[model samples]
Target: MSSSDIFIGEVIGTAVLILLGGGVCAAVTLKHSKARNAGWLAITFGWGFAVLTGAYLAGGVSGAHLNPAVTVGLAIEGGTEWGKVPLYLFSQLLGAMIGAVLVWITYYGQFQAHLTDREIVGGPGAQDTVKAVPNSEPGPVLGIFSTGPEIRNVAQNLATEIIATVVLVLAILTQGLNAEGNGLGVLGGLITALVVVGIGLSLGGPTGYAINPVRDLGPRIVHAVLPLPNKGGSDWSYAWIPVAGPLIGGAIAGGLYNIAFA
Candidate 1:
């Protein structure tokens, strides 16, 4: 495939990933809904399947490094071209944004309806009750459409992202190392899916374990742009951790894998 084709594939693959990924979050979190707080198990499995599909669709043509961290890690490990790294990252981010935009559109009506109902139910004096709704707060913030530990401290959140990314990258490296083919085939993809499930089941409690920067930032950008009642976009503050942590973890995993095997 040409570089342009690779770029297009990455963009489309990443978009699909975030659409399913964040769509699940919206399904489970929004008010007056059926899937609220259903369980972390569901989210984990959903994400696993989502990634599997995304990989199947894009792996052949573009290697499906839907996450920038993954692309960087592969490049650093000499598995991919350094010159293509920027293009891959840009494509992933663009795809993520597109996916996020679709997610916002999919759930916008529901969000607005919930918000309006809440206002009517609460009347003018229920400030606290309104604040409890996801994305109702005014300004940039994480976990607006999701839930994490009660503590909102940055250090704790960053730690959660770091650990989650470490586990995810490690899993990716392991799969990359042992797979028989150049790209992950069906069996290999299934194993990678399981890895995501494990991460979500074990490490998803804090900050929702958004191990991919595209996964987190893409949806967060949508949250900012979409007009929902009493909504605020928490940008810049906690965003960096998701981007930084995953890249660091991916690099570490690549280095460790090389040291152990090479």
Candidate 2:
């Protein structure tokens, strides 16, 4: 595909990915949504479905490498050109931002209620923990848009991301080595989506399983900038772990693929 094709495909695919993914988060977290408090199984499956939908929609055009870590891993494995990596990353980030904004718009009322409902009696639920103190840091609502460590240990969180991302990228690399040469042919998308669901279920408990760099960063940036009511801090301090650990893990996966699988 040409540059424009790759860019547009990634943008649309990633936007859809985040839209559905964030939508699920909003559904489970927000007060008024019908799926409120649906729990983590719904989220894991929802995100898997999101990946399946996005990859299928964009797979024909740009291979549907919507995550920067995926793109980097592919490039390191000689599956993608170095020159195109920047475009892919930029498009993914842009798509993530756009998707996040759409989520905010879709759940505008819910977010408002979720944020301010703390004043009201039994507002939202136990997840609605942020009280929004004056000038206080970003609150717990961030989990809807981005990932955070449950234990808050930098080394442990980073290690979790790296290890989980290795599993993810390695799965992709293995699946992509099919006869078709396309990274995870149409059926592989579904399988990869399941792999993501697996990661979320098995390894996600520690750090929310943010194995994708753009997936976390884009929405986190939107969280920081958007004028949502009483939306707490963006948690910039821990942002680097998701990005760096995933990149490191992806690169290691590529290296491992080269040494062991290739």
Candidate 3:
């Protein structure tokens, strides 16, 4: 495919991923909804399916490494061209940002309505009401942005993200290796979905298992700019963990895969 084609596919695929993936979160979290606090299982599956579809769509063109961690990891593993890495990573991040923006637009009306209802129900004395309403607002599930451990500490959250990303990257590497010059077809994608489900079921209670910078940062940006009831800016305090953990995990997975297979 041409360079322009690759860029287009990256943007469209990432937009679809975030639209469906983050859209599910909005459906579940926003007030006056049926899926409120439906638990991490739903989210995990939602993201998994999102990634699967996105990958299938863009794999041929851009390889669908929508997450920077994945792109970096693949490069380190010698599966990706080094020269193309910068372009791909940039495209992925840009695509993710665009996708996140689209998600915000799609859900803005619902979020506004929910926030207005909350403000009315809570009365003027509510803490959120007392705070100055910003030009933009955060999303309903704000916790997803920053890592908060079950123990409510940074170390734990970092650990959780690292472990989750490790599992995710490992799954990807394993699938690639097992392909034996062949490609992972649909079954491989399903395996990835299952891996996400496992992580959500097992490790999601803590840190919310960011596992991907694009997954967290893109949506977090939306949360920061989109109007809502009582939204806050990007939770910078805990933001580093999601990015750091995923990168470390991907690196570890790549190294381990190399050792085990070589």
Candidate 4:
């Protein structure tokens, strides 16, 4: 694909990925929504379908490497050109941010209702206090935008993200590669989606299984900047792990692929 196609496809694909993926989080987490409290299984299946939808929409145009982790892994594995990596990353991040904003818009009323609830915020003006990430736990809605650790330990959280991401990137490297050695062809997309669901079901408890760097960082940035009252802090303190751990995991998966499967 050409540069423009790659850029557009990635932007669209990633936006849809985050929109649907984050949409589920919002549906299940935010108050007043029908899907609220739908639980982890709902989120995993929602995200899986999100992947399938995005991959299908962009597969023809850009091969739909919607995640930077996938892009990096493919580059290291020699399936994608290093020269295109920056474009892919930028587009994906941009798309993810757009998607996150869309989620906020789609559930604007729900967000307002949830955050302003005295019980949810603990009091009338608690959002002001929750704005500082270093001072205390994250805002109530942070999980809608990005992942966080249940235990808040750096080592364990980082390890969970890295391991989950390795499984993700490695699966794409091996199973998502079609006969042409390019994108996740039709069936591959479905299988990859299922793999994501599997990752979420089996490994999401630790750190929400962020496996993709931009998937976490982009939305977190939006979470910080968006004008939502009582939205609380973006949790910047734990941000780097999702970014670094996924990249490390992608690189490790690529190297491991070369060692054993290349």
Please list the C-alpha lDDT of all candidates, in the order they appear.
Answer: 0.70, 0.86, 0.68, 0.89
Error of 2 at 88 (Å): 0.7
Candidate number that wins on TM-score, 1 or 4: 4
lDDT of 2 by residue, 118-154 (tens): 5532345523444443324546568888998889899
| lDDT rank order | 4, 2, 1, 3
RMSD of each: 3.8, 3.4, 3.5, 2.2
lDDT of 1 at 220: 68
lDDT of 2: 0.86
* Reference-based TM-score, model 3: 0.85
**Would you give me the overall lDDT of model 4?**
0.89
**79-151 per-residue lDDT for model 3 (tens digits):** 7656766776667667777777776677676666665654533446444562434433332346533334556
Clashes of each: 7, 3, 1, 0
Stretches off by above 4 angstroms in model 2 are 119-131, 134-136, 177-182
Model 1 per-residue lDDT tens digits across residues 1-262: 4688678779988888877777777676666557867766777887888788888888877877788777766766677778887888888888888887787687776666555564433456434353543344433223533234446787787777777777777677667533221356667777878888888888877767777877777666666666555554454456777777778778877787678754
Candidate 3 overall lDDT versus native? 0.68
Clashing pairs in 2: 138-232, 138-233, 139-232
- Candidate that scores best on TM-score: 4
* Model 4 worst lDDT run, 10 consecutive residues: 127-136
Q: What is the lDDT of residue 27 in candidate 2?
A: 95
lDDT of model 1 at position 16: 87
Angstrom error of the Cα, residue 63, model 2: value is 0.6
